[model samples]
Target chain A: MQAKLDKSDCMFLISDEKLNQFQQMIDELDLFTLVLPFVEESYQRSIWILDIWYSISNEEINRISNPENTMIYPYRNSILGIIKTLPIKRYIQLALYENERLAFLCAIYIYNELDDFISKKMAIKEEVKENFDALKKYSNKSLRPFFDSKYIEYENYPKKLAMLQNTVVNELHEIHKKYEIPLSWTFEKAIDDASKVYEAVFGLINDWGGRVP
Target chain B: MIISNQIEHLKNLYKDLKFLEVIQFGTITLPITLQEKRYDDALICYQYLASAYYENGSYENFHVVMTEYEKLCLTYGKDENKMYFYYLYSLLQVIVRDFDAAVEATKKSIKYAHFLKYHDLIVVNYYNIAAQLVHKKELEKARIGMSLAKFYKNNICESNITIVRGYIGALYYFATMGNNEEFQEVKQVFLKLIKDRQTFYDAKISFAEAILTLNLGQLEESVIFFEYAYLRFKEQQNIMFLINIEEYINNFNLGDKFQYTKELREIIKNSHRKPLDINNVKSVLSDLFEDDTSTLSIKYPNVISKELIVQHVEHALQNNETLYCFHWCFITDEIEELFGKLFVEQLLFTLFETVYHFIFKHNAEVNVLSKNEGEAFIRGISESEFFELLMELEEKLQSKVVHSKMGILEVPIHFGFIHSNQLPEKQASYEQLTAHADASLYYAKSHGQLYIYN
Candidate 1:
């Protein structure tokens, strides 16, 4: 079962729901009321996803190489796998609303993985290695401050996230000619891939430092 | 579906009082609700967000959110939405101590309620109006408002808290006006309404009681109530009441406690109402709106009803659980009128702290559970261990010297308890156990006993 939390709950956080809520929301994105807004959301969602994927992997940086098809993303399986492994519907939050809504959908999966590790009484050496592998490749300085244990300041987390939001906004505005702006991805896929980096830090902060805001 | 799902989860969070989470998730979905033309869902988002901000003591955020809520209601909302809009608007004004504006806002809500024929909303708005009016010292208008509240308070299922608050609002009016009989009447009914359960507004009642006793030349008598109300309001972070209490306590000479009280007040007043730290986070997307044709149909554009509309609520009764109930009463029943002035006043003033501190050891959980008044339980301990703790409390209470200005030495308190574990069957309904506790409490008080247990 997922935990219920709130602003008052501080680091523990708020909004409790089941897997179906997340699933239902993702399914609903396919039925957008407005075509323009829906497609725009899809584009923004893809931008966020590529930013996240690029942040972790040594992919063609800031350039989405969807030469085969504008709609078909290279990491489609991994993105879907991340969502499939996630216990709760966290990325559902990313599917609608903002131009760039980032939730670190993988945070849910990562947190759940941590939970499994803890309950199974397994050392997190393997998980930590996987996390660091994802972490070290980031070209963006968004996760710069939160990289080291000594630098993990909970008070500064929101500020850093806000900074990341600004960075994402600027990136969206430029629509870097270096990257192929995918026209083929669905809103559901875009949303599934959106939301990056912070929640991973959020999960780690919770797991190691037990500090969140 | 995303907006609706988020709204559904936000509603649940609000219901669960996970306000921080409400703010958390509400922040994410509110824009979606607005963007998707799910205005009602958007309104729900605003409602939860505003409340969450308020509950979290993010007053600046609260005001910001309410302003947006009001804007949303006016721009896209229909009649019923405007009614609720003004109702919430009234609350926003009240928080800032703008009594006149608050009263006006409430009356506006009442106007909408009248149009919608929502008797319950009318009742609540009248109560809100009464609260603001009382603060403004408009006793006659407040009385009328109170009467209106009482008339429409006939409706049942208005959520247990709202009904209780309506009564408390009326209680404030009656108590403030020195309508002692009406005050007592409303208080008795309210007490009956929440005998076995604690309420969020329990401190507000203490505040009213403090004001009533103060009016009756019982300033010293009012100290305990004021102190209780102060602590509780501080706990609740109810700034409005805390400010009101600060005004009262300025006249009170609580010595070191007053200084501590002043500091505590500063912390509470500053805590949630921090100026919006907008510098750290500016809106990156200032105008996300497309100004397209609104997905929602606009209706009932006329803001007010042409004719005065009235609706009556049908009266209904509702009332609760029990385990160990310890009723701690002060030992002052036998005092003469002459001694009452010097002894009772000085004694209360001198030792209320020491006494409460002493009792808090044994009765803090019980006091909080009962809101200082019904049924409480003790778990994770054997019945014999409980008795041993009780006996130890009695022993501690036997001799204690409280230093004060008058050099007042000591005071006694009566402890009455209902130990259900000691009962033959140890299985009693909530009512039976509480009635038994109340009986023992009264018995101990009348008999002038140190300890009485059933």
Candidate 2:
């Protein structure tokens, strides 16, 4: 009945205060159309990053309790320290490679946050309208169809969510099986993966001149 | 998916007492589950298979399955499954008449059940404890245990608890206390429950009824009920109950009408008795003749023969002499497996030899009824003398150290006795006396005592 926790040597480097601020931004950015997909994609991407960290790290971290102290921060510092010394082109390549599968998730999060602000109060607020128009100009063409087609109304949301979750679990199972990871490693791996993806997207937005919503 | 469905079906079959089908289904599923690395499923399969084997009286299969079950419990089983494993293990011990070991197993079961907060399992274990106590004749302790069981049953929600056994215990308690009115009241309730529930198919209910009827002085009705119960048990292949029923039937002199002649013939045919050689027969006859000085010429046709022994004992019964016949049954192969073949054989031999010497030393006429089977008949002893002799024998057996090739050991022996004069007929045959004694011996063995008399 007692489940063993993962002992992978990866850690979340973000402080509790910064994590709280990021969570607030997510809440404010929530729209039914974009937030569901963003949440699902972030969950999948987080697990992937955690799996990669577990495969690469030599240090065994106790992930059962106090993940920040025991696992996440150490992993974050190690990864960041290694990446900071890399050339700008190499850093860019690494970010792009990691964020490729997570592109739809980030685009949906950004578009929903912008659409909600524009529809709700942008017309009456000139500053808000200006910021929204600028954000739209910078938005990728690949993410435009999501807003134009009213996809949320046409799709079976529950079925889509279930299919997405099944895909994520199957992928995680494959990774674990391939690496001969113990069952105990699963839960901690998911938590570390989600936080890493969140941090990566947050940094990317900061570089792209977008403040936290 | 199909496997899960089949497992559910097997469970239903087990509940319905289709034990054969359950075993068949479990046999197929057990390997499949193991092959798939579903150890949890394998444990469940073993549970069903072992129980089915037990119900069917296939002790060999039961033993094999239980071994596997124990191993599974160690590896894959949780506390809940371990509790059930101990519970079933206790039942196996009970079947083998290892009451002490059974009590210990039940204690273990109670411990696990308590830790798991399984109130129903606790109630069942308490009931099992009460039953064992009753067998040990610790009536007060048994009543207390049964009271605890009842308390748990009442406190638990919507419990489908049957109070038939509780009523039976109360009946025994009052009967033993000589409280006729209370005994009658409890017997009425017990009988009513059996009737209303149509539980006559269960041999135990019939056996209990037979005992109650015998206590009420309805000997004829008791024989009929006992026979009904015995035949039912035989039909169900419940060998343990059959053996107990045989004992109860033998204790009373039911005359030729309820002698169980057919069953006796079956047993005799199956049994391989070793006949005494001519010289050994002569020596035994000479010893008997030399021991007796009475004018009554005892006719010894053949020595170490059941018929010759019965005839000689019947002569004493006809003369209105106070005579006691002691009946003993060796542990069968099934029992031997549980208690170890060597231990059982050695114990049987030692007890028979000790009793033979003690009876001879006491100036009683003893004859070996069936040497290979460990059965004997003794006569020319009064009822009081018989009881005193048993008490002495019990004390001696308890204290006597048996020196074997392995080491020194003390083996427990149980026997049964019946006085010829106690038979209903003034001119009862040797068969009647021996039967009664045999029945008494069964009671003695079951009750964890040295001897039971009628």
Candidate 3:
């Protein structure tokens, strides 16, 4: 499940039967709870499967080979497995949407993997060895220009993923009230999640210096 | 006072130092100081905020900022500085639909600018005024304004020439005169501007293209561009624009009675014999034509139709089969002068997508007659013609219309036309028969709009 993703590693095939099944479910289920199932299988190693499956669904997971394919996986995975990775401390932080705590937790879990993927992709190093050596050579103040240049440049991200995230977040909020989720938790989670991702990315960049402050 | 490059740099540094952290923390400061409070800081602040808001897609804020800027300028002193702010203010007014104010502001700005010998401000003022006059449907005034603007814009900076904006000037000029050739030429230029990313005015360019095509009686082309514009407007959440597009579509009447009558007959003919209880009409239509529904909607009604339930059936058919083209093409050639090229093209795209989606989503089996087929269908073909021979046998049986006979019958007919001289009415009913023949031809094409007696 955690194999290096290559062009040939994945194929997107929608069988007529599968489409029908999804359509049928769409008709019957509340659209908010509507989930499309996807599974990745590897021979033996339950822990590895669990880690990969959870990682695949998590938003913080970097290196999303196929965005559309990876997107459906989060909704397709086991809810319990997803919830377990969302530590109690994180869960409490998401207490703003207390009633829909489970849903927020699920979203946060997915958000984590997404954040990780985005950070890793944007985190530029001149060369593995060069960046590693920069830490030994350059002081923090000397690194200002290099870091400043990074922030000034804008990168285009696929809009569909952004739309998908917003849609999912909105749908969760729609269901939160019925499931007893508080609006506050949703807002808090967004802020916290964004901050944590930013901090983590900053740490990753700092790590190229090869010595933790 | 004028400053050298070195001093200008110092000025910029001083300004940056004055407002740096405040700007970062979301504060906007004017480069000009208001010692006497005779001028308005609100004008500069709102203008800067509006620029940022436009970038962020907060159109609501953009409107608010513009409105505030306008109010500030309206109340502030009239001077050289006023000329510069007035030009910017008028541009915003044009965008925000305050066309009258925009026109007035541009005029005032130009007068003050010339008096102050502010050449750059004069060009900006006149250019923006011309743009607003176009919006106000003042074609002659807009043209005069453009000529004046161009005279100055040309002399100042060769690199700063807004070629795309100039094309917009040409679009309005040709559109107002109803000169189809010139309109097309200007439209092509504006479209090239959009494709080349020469302007941030993609929506405006699209709107202009939609309007020009619509004015040229190119309904299909106009609708496509209008739909694109509609989507962009929706993203911007410009409610006023949304309403304008909706109203424009609602009033679009092609005005040709013959075409109207023909379209009516086509609609009526296709309205009968629809599958009941299928959410997906296209899939049902597919099954109706091809005798296959493995790929069709699973939900099917117990009865196709019951005479006792005629009203309900008719309502269902109407809901399922109707294709509504918003018809952005209805705006007279006169109104084409009122909109920019981008606005018109966007309106056209919106109309096209709406109608296309309605047609495609409602009837699965409805085959889109190829352009050649459509032409062939509308124009009658003789018996010796290939389509005539194909439909000859189907006409002989006249079996396609009967509901029970609908299943598993391949009618030999050219969907292009039928020489049905004896369509069950008097010889005086020749016009009616021709109309039905067109409907039958449409049916034979087995596009969802046509059905035959099985």
By summed lDDT, which 10 consecutive residues of candidate 2 chain A come out lowest? A1-10
- Give lDDT tens digits, candidate 2, residues B149-241: 555666678533243433544454444344567556656655654563433235655666677677678788878877887777766655556
Tens digits of lDDT, candidate 3, B260-313: 334333333554523222121111111122112111112223212112122332
Interface RMSD of 1: 28.0
Kindly list the per-residue Cα lDDT of model 1 for residues A99-189, writing each as its tens digit.
1112324332232232233223222346534433332222111222122122223232323333434433333223222222231122233
Q: Whole-model lDDT, candidate 2? A: 0.51
Ranking by lDDT: 2, 1, 3
- Stretches of model 2 off by over 4 angstroms after superposition: A1-213, B15-20, B56-60, B160-201, B252-257, B268-454
Ranking by TM-score: 1, 2, 3
Question: Candidate 1 vs candidate 3: which has greater TM-score?
Answer: 1
TM-score of 1: 0.38
What does candidate 2's lDDT look like per residue over A1-213, in tens digits? Answer: 001112222243324443343334333322111112211222222322333332222122422223433221232233233322322223332343344323323333333332232234433556544543433331211111122222344332223223333443343334334533332233233323332434432434334323334
Over B196-314, each residue of candidate 1 has an lDDT whose tens digit, in order, gives: 55345568788898888777767666777888887887776666667777777776554344445767567656766554443322111101111211211111121111111000000
TM-score of chain A for candidate 3? 0.20
TM-scores vs. true structure, each candidate: 0.38, 0.37, 0.30
